[model samples]
Every structure is written in structure tokens, then in C-alpha cells.
Target: MITKTFKSESTIQTLQLVQQELGADAIVVSMREVPAGPIWNPWKKSAVEVVAVSPNDEPQVRKPQPPMQMPPSLEVAEEIPEIEWDIPAKKKTAKLPPPIKLNLNPLSGQPAPVTETVRMTEPTAPSNDRYSPPALKKIQQQLTQQGVESSLIERLMELSAETLSPSTLADVEASKRSIVQLMGAELRVQKGAGAFVSNNVVAVVGASGSGKTSVIAKLALFFRQGLHKSVTWVCADTVRTGAIAEAKAYTSALGLDLKLVYTPQDLKEVFNGEQANDLFLVDTPGYNPCNEKQMIELGALISEMPSRCTYLVAPATTKEADLHQLSASLGVFNIDGLIITKLDETYTFGGIYNFARKSNTPLAYFTSGRETSRNLETADPMRLVSALFGKEWNK
Candidate 1:
């Protein structure tokens, strides 16, 4: 029987195509929605794929063959005829060079030379494991060890298996690069803080102890020292203990003015006479995601700054579910970017990638180490990718 597949933007259109190709009495074997558009466009709409066949088509049957009678006694010839045949010579193909290994170092902030290579004598053997072709199995294990969600790791393995050729899959280094590139493509890093400083007001909010205050200090130095812009520290975090004192200490060291605001009106007054060129970095109070009252109050303060570029500060050590809950709780603020903190404390960072994927928020910066000025780094996709492969973000 003959069958055909049809794809269209809509189910109705797919049905029409099936009918056109297979006639009115067509039977649909399967129908499903598949991603459409170019590979680079992740936000592309889905299209319907339908497999159909005509009902009139019938399977061809084969007739049975009659058995032939065989001689009772087998005849053995004393002399066998000698036959000579000419066989063509086999063509020799040139061997291709192995792919270069890439080192993922987050501290260098530059591409480093490959420090390791796969020795031919120690080649990875193929396996019957679920995430097989040993190279891909290694990739899966690395991702899992880095605390990446199991579902995402499986998806990455599938992508690696699908995109890499058998020869490439045999090479662990090539498979590693392919998997890293796949993750890097999904990560979205926004322009540096200097670019967003033009928005005039920058705000950061998070749960208590998420290093929100430290991130603010780092941003202050980044704008003042790095970008050469005047920065005003606004403290709206009245809920957290010592939050005000911490903000003051950071501001005092940076030689920047600090504005203390307890209410939305106070925050409004602080921004009423803001300078056009000066960057205002606002620090918000930490609130529990489960506390509706605190969330409402926090949202009210954020509403005061109509032109603010808000960032949701998340610790790298946060679990996937908690990260999702935090983002969902603060999603009402229309989070413009994400700031990942506490990178120095944890080794795994796959949760960050998962959060970015779910929220569709671009990462702004990543903070690590104890030093404020040197710790803040503009979000780098390769850095996160490096961490997923057991390379910690050292700097």
C-alpha cells in the first residue's frame, strides 16, 4: 500500500493536502505538531505533520512455489573445473585528522589552547547503554553531575546523537564541543550593564541572602570604574536585617551617594530629580515567594519605577524547582534580565540554564568570589557551558 506525509501550518491545511494527495478516502495514520521555521529561530510556531494513505490501495500477495524433487544420491566429481576471475583493486581513501579539543576555562576570559587530547590507544569503546556511543555517555554524566535537570540532559544527549555523525560521535572531544554549542545556542545573554545604564534606573530583587546587596555593589563599581558613569545607590530593602547597613558600607567604600526609601512614595521622590546621565541602581527587600502580602508590597515598589530595567537575582546553588518558583513569583515585575550570584560557592550551574530556558529572560551578569569589584562578570554563555562540563567558574 502507498502512503504519503503532509505538513502545513494548520491542521485544516494539512488535511486538505492529505486529501489532495491521497484522494477522499484517505486514512490518517498519524498527526502531530512539529517545530517550524529555520533552526535558529527558537520562537518559531509549530506546524502540523500528517501521515496518510489511500483506502483504495491494497497489499500485493505472493503466490506459493511448488517443491522440486531432488536426486536421491549426490554425485561427487573426481575432477573439479578450475575457474579464474579478475577482481577490481580496492580504492584507498585518505584518513582525516582528528578534531581539536577545546578547553573550557572561565577564569581566563579568553580562548585557551587545548590542554588535553585523546590518545588513539585509549579510544572510547562503543556501549549498549541508553546514552551510548561512550562519548555521548560521558557528556550525559558530566551534565548530570553538574546538577542539570535529568530531562534536559536527556534532550541534550538526543540532540548530540542526532547532530553528530558516527565518526564525530566516536571522538569524545568532538561530541563535547557539539553538546556545548547546542547549550550555548539556547542561552541568551543581554548587552553589558553599561548598555542598559541608559535606561536610567536599574533594579535588583531576590530572596533574602541571595547576595542582592553584593551584586549592587559590584554593579556600582562596574558603572563607576568600568563605564565611568555616576551611580546612585537606592535602598528600598527595609525588610531584611542589616540590609540597610550593608548597602551603606558598600556605598561608603565606593564614594557614592545612598538614598533610603521606605515606601513607594519615597522611592518616587528619590527618582523625581534624577540626573539624565547618572545611573540609579535600586536594591529591593528580599521576600518569601510563598508570602502573598510581601510579594504585593514588593511589586508595588517596582511599579514606582516605570522605566527601570529590573533584574531577578538568583543564586547558582538554587534547585530547579525553587528557581522556577522564584522566577514565577517575581514574573509580575516583567523581569528584564537575570543576575546569577554565588557562583564561587557551587560547582554546578545547569539550573541557571534551565531557569533561563523556562523564563526566556536574558542573563545580565554573574557574580563570584568575595571581592566586589573583580567578581562581577558580564554574562558569558561559554562560562555557563564550561561549568556544565565540570569546569567551575573560578573567577
Candidate 2:
């Protein structure tokens, strides 16, 4: 029997080649898959290597050779005693396995061809979404666990996948970079952190426990100490207990004044009495944002102070659906932008990013912890993107 090795781009091609080389009597003994070229070209893939042998024209006779017989006398075997046969004295030899084969080509570090049961596909260009970068699966799982909505997650994946060039898909790192850049570019970022400062009064409102009060303190103290501006704290949160004392303590500790107001007219008078350049950081008591009456009431109270900018304070760990509702409900208040809180508490900030993108509201400020006035800072797209990904990402 004569044996030959054949290689082609696909299973059908390999079989055709076998038929061409050894004619109709050719029998495939082995087959395997290998990479197309150096660097694993995704455009060209799934080459098959087949080992085939030719069938004999006729069966050949196998004559059994008689076993060697030793002479009866010991003296006759003295000359042959020098030879050693230390192998097990079995009557028959065990069939030897195929010789060790190793293919060490630089492009493909694989073992030599051998028999295989699996079929190989033809050479085909990278198709379908399966060949997407490794980062796609990683980001999908990360966002899914972070409580991002399935629709938003799917949209993000689809958008990023569309941006992936053939070259970008080949390198996962590049794919990750491209996606981050694309998201950041499409994002709505407002650089005017000081825009609200320019106005006389800044009214902060949000759901109860949304960190509205803490953000108020941070903004008031940050402006007073950092920018050396005169800031007055106002408490419109008459409902929640200790809410008055919380605003008073923060203001008094910094030698600033705090005002308490119950009605919209009361807040209107306080702003009316304040100096022209004084920064008024008004903190509103948090309430269930889903309550239409509560939101309308809050909006009316904020509408009292003229030249005021309203901000919807929210936490980063909030659910995506809630974030959307928060954006929509706060729209009644004529919200100028958003202030994201609790950065250090959770790793995910994608909900906020998506919220800002969907709401078309700029992220004015964000904080890491409840530091009196220290942890707060202006928003940066790169930093926010990095926080969302839970890793370093290029903008």
C-alpha cells in the first residue's frame, strides 16, 4: 500500500485532492484542522489536512517464516551468546504505534497530521457575531451583572459591534479601545461644572436617600472654601426629621448661614434677601420620585427662586429603569442637569451614563463618598467610562 498526505482549505477540497492524487482507490486514514496562515487570518480559516492511502490492486500472499531452532548442543551457540535480547520473551511482537510526529512550523505550532473523527468546515471569511472581540462578552457579562437593562445592554453591544472593523475584531484590545472611544464620543458631556455656580440659587432634588443633602453640603463647602465665594445653605426639606439640623450643622460649621423654608413663597423671600453674588445651595428633602404629586410639589417649590438651576441628584448604583424614571419625572422640575453620587460604593456607573445619554442631561458633578466637601469633583468622561467598565479604558 502507498500512503500520501494531502492538505486543502476545506473538507471537500481535501477529499477532491485525495481523489485526484490516488484515484478511486484512495482511502482517507486521518484528517485534522489547522489555522489558515500566520497570525490566524480571520478572513481565511479552517484548512483541513488529510492522510490517505492507496488500495492494493490485489491481495499479496503472506508466507509464515518458520521460527529459528537452536542446536541441541550448548557448544554450538557459544558464538551467538554475545548478542542480548532483553525484550520480554513474548511469542509475538506487539503492534507498534504510529511514529511520534511533531510539526513545529512557526506559523502553526501543532502536532503532525493524525486520524480524527470530527469534520472541518471550508475556508470562510469571518462571519456572524460569534467572531466578535473577547471584550464584547466580557463587557456584556459585566453590564448584565451591574443591573443594566437588557435592552440597553443589547443596544450597546450592537452599537459597538457595528463599529468593529475587521482589523479591530482581530485584536481584542483594539476592539475594547474602539468601543470606549465610540461610546464616549456619542455621549453627552457638559463641561460647565461652574455654570450652576454662576446662577444665584442651585436647587437640588431627588428621591429620598438619593444623596441630595450630602451633595448640597459638598457643593456649598466646595464653592465657599475652594473658590472663596459666599455660599448660603437653605433647607426646603421640612418633612424629613433631622434634615433641618443636617443643613444647619454643615453651614454653621463652615461659618455660613442656613435658612429654613416651608412654602414656595418662603424660599422666594430668602433668595430675594440674599446678596447678588452669594451662592445659594438649597437642599430639598428627598421623596419618592414615582409620586406625581410629590414631584410637582417639589418642582413648584424650586420654581420660587428666580435665576435658579435645578439638579436631580441620584446614586450610581441605582437601577437602570429607575434612573430613566428619575430623569423623566424630574423633567417636570425643569431640571438643568444631574449630579451622580456614591461613586466609591459601587463599581458600575453605566446606568448613570446611559441615563445621561438618554435624558440628554449633562452630568455636572459626581462624588466618591460622603466627604464633607472633599470627594466631589467635576465630571470627566474618561473617568466615568473607566468606572463603568471597572477598569482603565481609553476615551
Candidate 3:
């Protein structure tokens, strides 16, 4: 038998070549397509290789010959004995035996035996070791040491190291800046006319214990002290205990006018009667988000008020889930912007990013420490980004 292998881009061409070389009866034993070179090369596409085998000419067998008798009277009968006839006789061809046939059926009590041997090897578990630098592992270990859960640490490490790898510490800072830029792009608000109003009539509304009183006082102080604008405090929080007196005292301390409002109707009546000159800082009652009545009343009050509704989101030491729920619950108020407080607490301030992303709420101001209005600053995206990534900001 003869065997041949041919490789070509076209299977039909390869078969034709094989048939041309070895007769048309050539049988195809095996065929496959395999990559030959790099994928970048246009001519390196996978091609088919065919392996073929053909039968060769069979060998002939000799036939057996009978023993030859001696030439009878060859030397006496002939005039002169032929020299060729005196020579020994050659043997005749003998017939070959029939070829043996193989039986392939197992039911016929004739089958080929197969043997298999398997060597037992130790089982190996999949490796969980990640291909990362020692610095990343150290950072993960540090976070774990600081009581951070393993799952969150793993996520943080993945976001920091794998997604944002830095060649040097400086590059790490640059990467952080880029992430902050992306975050800022998400949080950026449309640039409007100056201050929404020359004398801004801002109303701070939120749930109870959301630092509404403190935020009101801070805004009043910020306008009076920082911007030197005349500020008026409207004490609309008549529900909470001592809320009225607290607002009065804070307004008195800053030497600002304080008015009492029992309902949204009364707030509108008073505002319409009085002339609008200075900033009217309306302080609303701290309504529970879960209470439907309070939300309805607050919504009515906001709809009536002449000032812009700025929802105070005082997220301090709060979980991300709670913040998300709060943001969703208060979304009915149609809050214009956010005012985040209690920034000094909690290193993992992922809630800020969550709120900015999920709520699509732009930040207006942020208060860190409880210093009345000392640590309060206009919430700029670049500054917040720098703080979250621990990047130094240029003063």
C-alpha cells in the first residue's frame, strides 16, 4: 500500500491533486483544518490537510515443478548428443495457497481484544492565586486587617489594581484623577444663570434628624458671613418638639428675621405679603420618609413655596442601601440638588458615589464637621473626587 499527505486552502483541490498523482481510487484516511501562522497575516488563514492511502501492485507466487527424468539415450540416439539436452532440467512454477480471510464479527466467536491501563494520579485543585503585584495584595491585606469584609476588599482591589494599574505611585495618583474626572462628568450640573436668583430663596427639606436645623443655620451663616448677603430664616418646622424655638434662637444669634409658618398655605400667604429683597431661607419640618402624610404635606408645601427646593441628604455613617432607599423615597419631591452632611465620618464613602450615580443628583454643598458653618463648602465635583481617591488637591 502507498500513503500520501497534501495540504491546501481548498479541500477539492487537495483531493484532485491526490487523484492526479495516485489513481482516482485513492482513499482519504484523514483530513483537518489547522492554523498555519499568525492571525495578522492575511495569507495565514486556516487550511485543510488531507491524508490519503492507495493500494500498490501485488507480488506474484511461483508454481511448484515435477522432477524431470534423465534424457533417455540422448548420447546414443542422436548423431551427436545435444549439449543443451544433457544439462540438468529446470524446476516448473508452483501454485500459491489461498489467502487467509479475517472474521470481524464478535458474535461469530472471533473478535480482536483490546487492553487498557490507567495510572492513578493525585487530584489537583484549581489555583486561586491571582496574577497581581505585591502592592495590590498588601493593599488588600491592609483593608482586611482594618476589618473590611473580604468580598468588598476583593472588589476594591479589582477596581484599583486590575482595572486601574499604575506604573508608579505618581501614575496611581493620575489614574485616580482620571476616575474622579469620570465621576465628575456624571455629577456635573448644567450651568445656569447667576445663583438661580440674585437673592437666592432656598428652602431646605428632608426627613427628621437629617440635620435640617443645622443646615438651615449653616446656610444663614454662610450668606451673612461669607457672601455678606442679608438672610431671613422662615421657621416652618412647627411639628417637631423645640424645632420652632431652636430656629428662633439660631436666627436671633445671627441677627436674622425669623417667621413662623403653621402650614404650606400660611407660608405662601406670608411670602406673598412680604416684599422679596434678601434671601428667604425657608426651614421645613423634618418629615419621616416612610410616613405618607408627611411626604404629601411636604410635597404640597414645596409646590406652594416660591423658593427652589434643595433636598438635604445628610448621609453620615449610613449604609449604601439606606441612602439608595432614602434617595428613591424622596425623589417624589423633585429635588433640584443635594446637600451632603456629616462627611467627616466613615472612610468608605461609597454611598456618595452611589447617590450621585443612581439618583442622578448633583451635589450643591457638603458639611464635614459640626461647626455650625465652618466646614461647609460648595460641593465641587473635582474636590469631592480628590477627597474620595485621596488625591491631593491644589488649593
Q: How many residue pairs clash in each candidate?
A: 0, 0, 5
Model 1: CA > 4 A from native: 1-131, 192-198
Candidate 3 lDDT by residue in tens digits, 86-127: 233575543322221212111223322212122345799999
- Weakest ten-residue segment in model 1 by summed lDDT: 98-107
TM-score leader: 1
Can you give the lDDT of residue 225 in candidate 1?
80
The weakest ten consecutive residues by lDDT in model 2 span 76-85
Stretches of candidate 2 off by over 4 Å are 1-130, 147-171, 392-395
Q: List the residue pairs that clash in candidate 2.
A: none
Scored against the true structure, residue 235 in model 3 reaches a CA lDDT of: 84
Q: lDDT order of candidates, best first?
A: 1, 2, 3
C-alpha local distance difference test of each model: 0.77, 0.69, 0.62
Cα lDDT for residue 210, model 1? 91
Which has the better lDDT: candidate 1, or candidate 3?
Answer: 1
Native-referenced Cα lDDT, model 2: 0.69
Query: Would you estimate the TM-scores of all the predictions?
Result: 0.65, 0.61, 0.57
